[model samples]
Target: MFKHAIAAVLLASANVAAPAVAQPAPAPSTAQAPLQLWRLDCGEFVIKQYGAFFSDTFQYPRGPKNIVGSCYLIRHGDRYMLWDTGLTDALVGNTFDNAAQTLRLRQSLVDQLRQIGVRPEQIELIGISHWHFDHTGQAGRFPQARLLMGRDDVELLRGTPSPDQDSTDALAHWLNGPGQIQQVSGDHDVFGDGRVVMLTTPGHTPAHYALLVRLASGPVLLTGDLYHFTEQVANRGVPPFNHNRADTLASMDRFDRIARNLGARVIIQHEPADIAKLPAFPQAAQ
Candidate 1:
C-alpha cells in the first residue's frame, strides 16, 4: 500500500516540468563556522510501518513496528549543518500523498530547525544520504549552504523529475545559482578529525551514504535508509524496496564491522526505538 501510494505520488508529481533557467552561483564565505552538532526529530516524516515486512533475501529484518523518518542538524562553530532534509511543507498534510504519508513528515524540516534555534541562513553545509525525495525535500530551503552529496546520487537526481521537481530545484539551486555544491567522489570527513564523517554506503541507492558522528557518548553512525531499524542490523534483513540487494547487504556488513571495531552506536534513521535512546537536542546524552 505504501509503495503504491509512493508510486502514484511520484507519477502525479512528474507532470510538472523543471525550471529551464539556472540559478545564480554561491559566494565564497570566510565566516567562522561553529562546531556544535544537534540531532532534531523534525517529527515523523514518513508513514510506512515497515516493522514486519521482509525483503526477498531476508538478509535483514523489518522493524517490529512502523518506523518514523528523521532529520539531523549539526552545528559547526557558528554555522549550522543539515543532514538529510525531510519532506517539504507543501506535502505535509495530504494523507493520500505518497512520500509525505509514508514518511509521516507532518512538520516542515525548516520549521523544526528553527524550533531548535537554527535558521536556514545559518546553515553552512547540507549532506544527503541519497537522492530520495524524502531525504532531499528541503534542499532548496538552504541556498547558502554548500550542498554535499555523492556524485552518483547527484546524477540520479539530475536525471529524474517529480511532481514538485524537488531534485531539479535542488540541483538548479546548488548547481546553477549561488549555492555551492561539493560533489564528493566517495567518503568525506565533514569536519575533519573524524568528528563527523560521511561514508559512501551504496545499495539503497547507487550513491547512498551514511554519517559517522563522534558524540560525547561514543561514535554514532547514522544509517540513512541503509537499514530501517536495529532489527534489520541484528537479523540482517533488507526492506522489500531498494535499488540493489547485493549492495545493501554489503553495506550492512560494513556498518556492523565498523561499529564493532570503533565501539560506535549505529543509529538507524527510521527506528523509533533507536532514536528514543539518543538524547534530544539542548541535552546531549549518549
Candidate 2:
C-alpha cells in the first residue's frame, strides 16, 4: 500500500514537471516600422463660422467665420494614405456661401491630388476621423481605396438615426459602395507597430478618432475635432455641442496624457494657427 501511494505521488510530480517542460517561450515585441508624415494642402476647404462649436462659444471672434480645410498625406513604404478628404463641389452652393464669408475655398480634392502628381487611384487607404460631411465629402473620389473608420462611426453611418441629421447623401452613398470598408473598434496599429496608430477618442461624435504618427521629428498627434483649437486644450474645455459632455472631457484628458507621454505635437484639424506652424508637403522644397 505504501509503495502504491509513493507511485501515485511520483505520477503527480511528473505531470507537474511535464507542463513546465512543454511551456513555450514568449514571443518578442514587434519593432515599429519607420514612417513619414506629409501635410497635403487640399487647396482650401471652407468651414462655416459657428459650424463647429469651440468650447462654450458657438461663433468665432469674427462673426460667422469661414476657415481653410487641411488634410494629411501619410506615406508608409510604397503605399500612400490620406487622413481625411476635403470639400466636394456639391458644397459650393449659395447655402454654404451665405452661411459664412468664404474665408478660403480652393480647388477640389481630386484637383489638388492631380496638382501634386498623385492620382486618386494611387491612394491605398482613406482613414476618416469621423463621419462629418465636410471631412468625408470627397471620400467617394477614391472608389478603390480601402476606407478605415471607427466601428461606432460605421453603425452611425449605416442608417442609424441621430438627432443631428447632418448626414450627407453623397457620404452615405460612398460608404455603401463596392469599395472595401475596414471598421476599427478601438486603438489600431496601422503598420502592426507603434509607428502609425489610430486611437479611438469619442466625444464630438460617438466614433471620433485621433491619429498618432511616430515621425522623425518626433511623435505627432492628429486631433480630429477632439479640440477644435489650442485654447480648448489649454483650458480643458468641453464644447457645448457634443454627444456627451463627460465623455468629451475624459477624451481631452486622454489627449493631454498621450501628447505629454509621447512628447508629441498636437495638430488641430480646423485651427488655422496650428496649420500655419507645420511644414507643408514636399518637405525638401519647403
In model 2, the clashing pairs are: none
Estimate candidate 1's alpha-carbon lDDT, on a 0 to 1 scale.
Answer: 0.69
TM-score of every model?
A: 0.76, 0.78
Reference-based lDDT, each prediction:
0.69, 0.67
lDDT for residue 248 in candidate 1, whole number 0-100: 86
lDDT of 1 by residue, 172-232 (tens): 7875677788887667877654567888788888888898877655677888888776656
**Per-residue lDDT of model 2, residues 65-115, tens digit only:** 334566787777667788877655555432344443343335566766676
Residue 102, model 2: Cα distance from true site in angstroms: 4.7
- Global fold similarity of model 1 (TM-score): 0.76
Cα error, candidate 1, residue 62 (Å): 11
Q: Which numbered prediction scores highest in lDDT against the true structure? A: 1
